[model samples]
Target: MDMASALASLSRLQHPFSRQRSGWLLAGTLALGAIPALAQSTSGVDGVWSGTAQSNGQQVPLKLEIHGEGDHLQAALLNGKQRSASSSGSYTDGHLALQFDYYANSIDASLKDGTLTGTFSSRGRSIPFTAQRNTKAEPSSPNPVNIGGDWEVEVKSSKNESAWTLHVKQSGPNVEAVIQRIDGDTGSLFGEWRNGQYEVSHFTAAGPSYAVLRPQADGTLQLVTPAHGGTTQTWTARRPQQARAAGLASPDDPLQHTRLSNPSQPLAFSGKTLDGKTISNTDPDFKGKVVIVSIGGSWCPNCHDEAPLLESLYRKYHDRGLDIVELSFEEENQLANPTRLRAMIQQLGLTYQVLLTGTPDQLNEKITGVEHLDSWPTTFFIGRDGRVKAIHTGFAGPATGDAHRDLEKETDALVKKLLS
Candidate 1:
């Protein structure tokens, strides 16, 4: 899909949490509906089972690591580098259920004819999933291709061009990789090397995605990623020695230009806090203070990843002229928006002020006077003089390791310079 279509998909189906208790109850009901007839047998269900979950005609690669015996069971969902552990799970009789406390979601399935079939339910949506245990071990390659190294990758499509770091490690036929982008690491891509091709896939709360890497004759890795909307984009990655350096962009980089028509003009906005108290750009807390206007929503995984760092920044500099105002573009329902924000705040222990900024388009119009909002978790740094100083388009959360560290260092330096 194009960037616009991807953004539309994000804004429409971003919120994964149910606003009402009844919705969660309904999710539980739907989860249990998979097992109508119970047969007692737990054999052949152990070990790592991998498969795909289908939702809205999109297939998400899923890996479930199930362990323990009887009612006391453990399960972990692996999507890229994102791993969610279920606090409680049970494989009793022919029924299987795993509850993820973090997402208020559950996966319920039943074993039948050497295959487990069920649905993954969260919020109000259910995705059908099936998994089969690997009966045959993958044969080790006679001459394993060593693709283990750091690489600079550039992905170009009709919509946009972006740079990233590809970190790959291989042991025998097992290959593990992480794609470090400006926003964050693409979770963990865990797969195996077979023949001359390396294929990996991950399924996260956002959706399911996969990448195929083929080693070219010239030693460059060619990557193909399929979008949920049926569009495929190709990327090329080469080792740092052979590739041009496409280092992560700093906040002050000239290439990091603002799209706003009048950036020097102090951004104007008016919204209510989660408590319904009115707030504006001209509020006393922001006067003469270096403010960071954070544009994000509770429904975004990247936003969730960015929240803790923002909270730490607030705690470190709030008294020293640093103020953060989170303008949340949330679900359409007015009541659900605040509730979601509250949950997010409580979960992250955020002390900064959060306001309801409507949908993504509404936030774009309100802040930049434009109709196009490109990415979630975009942050605008406003100097003490009240003019916009820098605009950060996306967040690279801690999962990116050193990439995230570089972002923190640059952000801290800029904030300090503005404070001075």
Candidate 2:
């Protein structure tokens, strides 16, 4: 694999959740019902095709099979992992139109020679993909982690704190095990694994997701995404001689005090929504219910990881009179504009109210009264009476292995306790 293809392949490994390698998931299941022969003639969509789907920065290769008999057409999408996504629709004029039950999912282009270029909609979001004719193809290389084994790992960061852990496990392709976070929290080793990697979807009282580990080679793990385009970080871990400290305290934990304890201050600015609606401490909705203010930019990958989780939580608890506000510090000036903000809200199918936060300097003043913040994706959870319940400083993306486990545990306990 050249640099570009290697990069693309790496992307696929990261986001197996959405992309389909073969005939997996949505692309495999989406099929257009029926179309008029005249419509097909005009659309000119009669062929086999191939494509890839990209979300944030992760990419998944896909295969599309389109068989159109006159105006009647049938389309099938095969993802990188052999997941199937199929859809059916008719052509009108020169447009090959198809509909996915999910909104954000879209089909990008019409059929062409042995390929179709388009996107699939899911969770009110769209990731571009393509498909090609079905043929016997080579299977993907086996994922690094063995069913049972000890692996060496390390993480070093000059921009942020550096840490290491021994991921002890017993399982295969997917493993079941525990990861020792260098900056461990309470010696609370979360839960058991089902497949191999920690089952982040489930929860235990002890902790959040990091209980499992995804094996990484001794080489540097380069991080890239739409948000931090040119940013890169090198990380590696060594195998431990014996069982290491489980609840080893992070020396830097004390420095985190300032940002984690105080919550009376607001991270958002006083402004109207994109539609020119006013929002502030004086708003009627602000008077009651726990208000959660999130500082993020649409371009951030960490935000992408946390946004969906936040949106899900907000919807689950909003009816209980819970108030959650998003303060987006978008890099796009257009996104900063109220009109563009409105368009983004519609385009992204966001149901929460998002305000345009000022510059980084201004944001410093907004959250200054509390503690200090360094990252772009910080969340401050307020209580029903409008008091700060918790101040979560950063995101633990799915890639982090164990960060997500701890986050969910903290977030769930806090949210449920407040609701009760």
Candidate 3:
């Protein structure tokens, strides 16, 4: 892949934001009458399922929550505790197919008796999986040690080392965890204390996701996660206080990571809306308006997390002379059809204009007046003066705990300042 596509492909690897979600839980089996078209064929396969995908020899668990009417289907691959997803599909014959529309991935499964066998496929890679109807049972007893709290985690990757915040919450034997950077976090890792280690599992519609946490005698955590090429990455965790006193540095400030080529000038770019109308800072709708320019993609997980936050801001400030425009990059298929993009806007109840900027490979060539875009979901705050006021790279959504809230407050304050 070229630089732009590589950046886009790899940008939101560990990013997640949160919204109030009425989760689709695995609840036994769906009765024969649940879906009209599949009533006869999908009787025992219509409800929630416990599934695992086998990549190499590693198994990653996920919850498949299926509920729909007629031939249409709305499915959720519940990865860990929080999955920023949007889905659609159909159930025909004994075959079931689910598309993570925005994420640009899908699952094709077939049911035999109560067992479900399928392949979760994305972007040319496919992992085979097997699932079975769930039995709703409470979690087992708590772990011998509660590894619940925030800690400073240092990840040692093959190419580099980076700092991350490990947020873990445990209930009985059920444990939920996510690794956070200043930008955001990995969506969620939910599992239980199994054997001698805490096995936290995650399965995004794309890529590998699983982590094993072992509590050491020193009251810290040792995490081992699978990486590219069957290699494993190791992480050491320590309390923030301990990390701070030991003089470990944190991730860089997001606001400082990206900047404009010239702050005195407006962002120099135009994009075609989903309907093919070009819009830019020079447009009248943005004239004298405190505008927010968001750079993202429908196929991005972090971008999915950041959309609602932008929508909330736009809804609150649009009438007060604020306008938010999303310049969304996408895959070739979405760039051509944009069906999923429209579905996403409707699914999220977004009213702001989303422009189809270009394919991921065209990102750098399409945008101007920016030094560089460090990550997906980057935002530029422009004042009514038509000058760039601030540029915040990446998102610190609810996944970052206090940092997300803090960023929201800061964003509100900045918008208020720019509007004033």
Candidate 4:
């Protein structure tokens, strides 16, 4: 189906926690009142439903719990094993209208007796979901959107800061693409797209890096920026209107930039906190805490998003002896001065000790070079004994909510192990 319609179908899926968040739900319900509800039928699908979905040749079992009042239909996916991604739509007429974040369109599924026995389309793939209603069954989750094909994507950074042109091809569930730099030389990228989300391992002429994209329902895609840690913008592709091979490639040249690692390299420092508190590598106070040293700036949008999450983690685990030090890269040259650094920390409401690193050039020289740093908001986790644990570069933000979810899961596991 078309992108708009595909998105609508995915939007109909809902989260189980909706009722608990009444304010947000109320606003959404009011805004979405224009959409039609499920069709009025003698089909007794007004309860819990469950089934398996084999879409685009991938099979995933789904459990759906529908709460219907009169003409309105609200359903939640009962399975938490899948990600928390959900949709909202009304069942009206014979069509099941739904919307999802990963599609640029909504989907209209023709259902017979709560079964998706008719045609359905999402992310340019039109397939049938042979759904059957089970009174005692839970709902099944089909994959989100399927952006499985050859695509020519051009990413223009906001305000012409930078741009990347990609010639991406999807083979089955795997993603293999070549990105052309501004000078026309090509670098490679690899990953996969399932349910309309992209987990790409981006490499310039450099080494391994990462990127995630969320396809919207209106055929427009949301580019989850790793730099700013939040939703950035919407992009729509103009597919060639002519008949071409489903997995075809164009001869156009792609844009390129310096290759940087997705997870940037670690930087060492021997500095004090932003509040003029003496904290050096030899400090006895940090002898046994899971420490995190960060390279970030308050002016950076990506850093703004990451700082809050870091603050959340600190608050949650600081009592358990989690020590965090932020190395600030302010616009001023005297950034290493603690008095100036504390102002930046106060402005961001960051309770952690922030040390002023040197100038950006000096900062680059002191830490690993900036060329190795793909984006801002870089983090390096340290073990209790002070050795490096992991380096996470770039912030995917709430736009690619799933990526952040995975990050939280990883962090929790590590923290739990340390606590234990």
Which candidate achieves the best TM-score against the true structure?
Answer: 3
lDDT rank order: 3, 1, 4, 2
**What CA RMSD would candidate 2 show?**
12.1
Relative to the true structure, how large is the alpha-carbon lDDT of every model? 0.63, 0.44, 0.68, 0.45
Model 4 error, position 28 (Å): 25
Model 1 lDDT tens row, 1-420: 963344334333322221111100101000101111111224546656667777434455566656655677765554433445564688888789887543445789998988889988765677799887643334645676778778777654221435567877777766666665543345456566767877765555333445667788988898766544556567788877665444532122221623456665787777778778889999887889999888877766667777777888899998899999888876676335455567567656789988887775576566765222356677888899999888776676654557678888888899999999
Over 1-420, each residue of candidate 2 has an lDDT whose tens digit, in order, gives 553344234333432122211001111111121223322332356443433455434343344444444345554432222212232355544456553221123454655564556655543456566554333333223443342433334443332443533343333333333222222221212222233233211111100112223333542221111223423233343344321333222323312533643455444346446666767755767776777787765443345456667777778888886677777664345444444345335433578877766654465665556554655567777776766667666565543455567777778778878777
Candidate 1's clash total is 5
Total residue pair clashes for candidate 4: 70
Choose 2 or 3, whichever is better by TM-score: 3
TM-score of 4: 0.39
Extract clashing residue pairs from model 1: 80-187, 80-188, 81-187, 81-188, 183-396
Tell me the lDDT of candidate 3: 0.68
Which sections of candidate 1 miss by over 4 Å?
A: 1-50, 54-61, 65-75, 79-82, 86-108, 111-115, 121-126, 132-142, 152-154, 157-159, 162-165, 180-185, 228-231, 239-259, 333-340, 369-373
Best by lDDT: 3
| Poorest 10 consecutive residues by lDDT, candidate 1 | 23-32
Cα-based RMSD of candidate 1: 10.3
